[model samples]
Target: MGDFNQSVVLEAIRRSGEGSSRIELAEATGLSAQTVTNITRRLLDDGLIREAGRTINGPGKPRVTLRLVPDSRFAVGVHLDPAVMTFVLLDLSGAVVRRTSAHTPDMEPRRIVEAMAATIDALITGSGVDRTSIAGVGIAAPGPLDAEKGTVIDPPKLRGWNRVPLQAVLAEATGFPVVLEKDTTAAAVGELWMRRASADDSFVFVYLGTGIGAALVREGEAVRGSTRNIGEVGHIIVDPDGPSCTCGSRGCVEVVCTPQAIVAQAAHAGVFPEDQGMSDVDAVEARLTELCDRAADGDALADGVLRQAAAHMSVLTAALTNMLDVDRVVFGGPFWSRLADVYLREIPDRLERASATRAVRSLPVDGTVVGDDVGAVGAGCVVLDSVLSPRASALLLGH
Candidate 1:
């Protein structure tokens, strides 16, 4: 179990934060001092960790402290949206060491896939990190996804993404393992990595992007159902007589709360000038951000439009809290960064008044500070989990 102990030594240092002395590592891991020294030597030779400093522990000797060398390896995360594709490169410590973005190409999947491969190759080469040290790549696209097979299975956001073997294709190009996850789940994972919060053993992440969805994470793993679509909160019919969704439903949460719906409502209210480019969720969000800024600065028309959007969002929050029974709700994606204040103020009130369990308990909602990069950063964390997590790593290593 030399390798296992070595891995544990590295993880212990990481969990202990900045640096840990040899004695600290031995105590923290319940391993012998000689075993820790041996593991640290191998880690140092592998360039995975480096000495941070030395502490004088006794009269005769000083103990060297060890810390992760963030640049030891890199993992990449790609978030695919209709309007823009965000790429993030994270070092071993799960920090975004580099980032790049580009406009999403037309609806052709092949062209978009090729472009993604090219972009990744260029980024890796430019950074000059050894290819072997690249642990894995995580791709967070919309669902319903075939998580087992790593396929994108008919995501409403990407029209032609049906049955696409994105994981295998990307693995072939990058020569590293690829993990495919739903965008909302990625956002939840991102929140976990960023917050390192242990508030609950179980929580739900409400992701507001092109559409609203929830990712239920329990005990450090996302919950996927038999069909691999456990958290499709967007299609949860909140109002049967409301509005028709493209899924042919009358008043699903997505139909009323998506960015597209907000922009459409704003256009109908004579807020935005037109709806040509606002068709894209990202474009609509950018426009909405501008509108929110104007509204916050006292634009009467913009204020009304944003308020309407916030009201719809509030309704969705109330419905989710009632259904999920989750104590903690993490608000994520690009929308949270711009409209978090709006949701934070309006949602709790709505939940208190309308939530089914309001009389029994209070549901606390908070927006993730990780913001727009949450999905990308969370994707990187997913890959790191594959390497470090007990279950995920065992499966990956075929032990």
Candidate 2:
């Protein structure tokens, strides 16, 4: 009947996975059966939900099951890294239907926005999904951003993106509502939504990309700090006596455990060719992938560099987990595929030894189920979350 009620009913059906009955929806949402019936009628009429046969119990009347129509809606997710831009189209179920990628172009805000809009247009046209059914675009970009204003504020490696009104620009360019979020936070949202995490689940998502960062998710919501810049983990000091960081700190995680740092370490360890110039993002990514491949193939020097990076990552991760009192940690991002094995193996042991709750609970470290595209998919989930997920603010507004 209203936005709040609609979101609650839809969320219940989506969370039900296979399907749910009105009785089940009423129980899950804590709404009256009459209210669930009215909302279900509206959803059915709107084609957002459909009857999926019936469940017949022994002596009672057969109850009809309703399920979300995945084709009823679609959302586009864009993950903009310093090196690459990933685009994904996701359905109501958070399944990626079509995906594409391109090298990040110039840092000029207008050009980047136009390029992204063009890519979105191409994706929608290629997918042949009804244009009206498409929700909007969600962007996951490197942050230190003004999430409330949808502005990019001096993120590393993006030279010209200083206080750029990215959300408004993208909205204007594409004629679609836009939701902008930090890449790590968006990745955490994606994991929570895609995995259908209950409100009780809590975890920290470690995002390994060109730079390293993290997002703390508690009760299925990402912890946005006072300025909505909570996940700046790169600056966390891991080694007090190690190399100096650009943040004017010694042995910061960003300076020691990032992809750039790992590649630099590999180069120093004689993993790359002497003449190879790691001046550009592409060069660094290429060299890093080569190093990971070599390490996987039993190159001792490369393996040692990666293991050392993983160890540094574990320290930061353990600290975050202990401070936040979360039981799980998830790793994801473009660089994650290359470093997942090392992190999984190395982080768990370090966490077990370092965590304050080690005697009470064993923390689990795992990779994202969405794989390397978790950030992009999470971006898309941001849009769906905004539209379908119920929020406390709605109750305050009496929606």
Q: Each model's TM-score?
A: 0.86, 0.97
Tens digits of per-residue lDDT for model 2, 115-168: 899999999999999889989999999998887888999998788888999999
Q: What is the lDDT of residue 57 in candidate 2?
A: 61
| lDDT over C-alpha atoms for residue 310 of model 2 | 85
Which portions of model 1 miss their true places by more than 4 Å? 1-9, 22-42, 56-63, 199-201, 239-241, 273-283, 354-362, 392-399
Candidate 1 C-alpha lDDT tens digits along 15-51: 6677999999999888999999888998899888899
Global lDDT of each candidate: 0.77, 0.88
Where does the lowest 10-residue lDDT sum fall in candidate 2?
Answer: 390-399
Q: List the residue pairs that clash in candidate 1.
A: none
- Per-residue error at 198 for model 1, in Å? 3.3
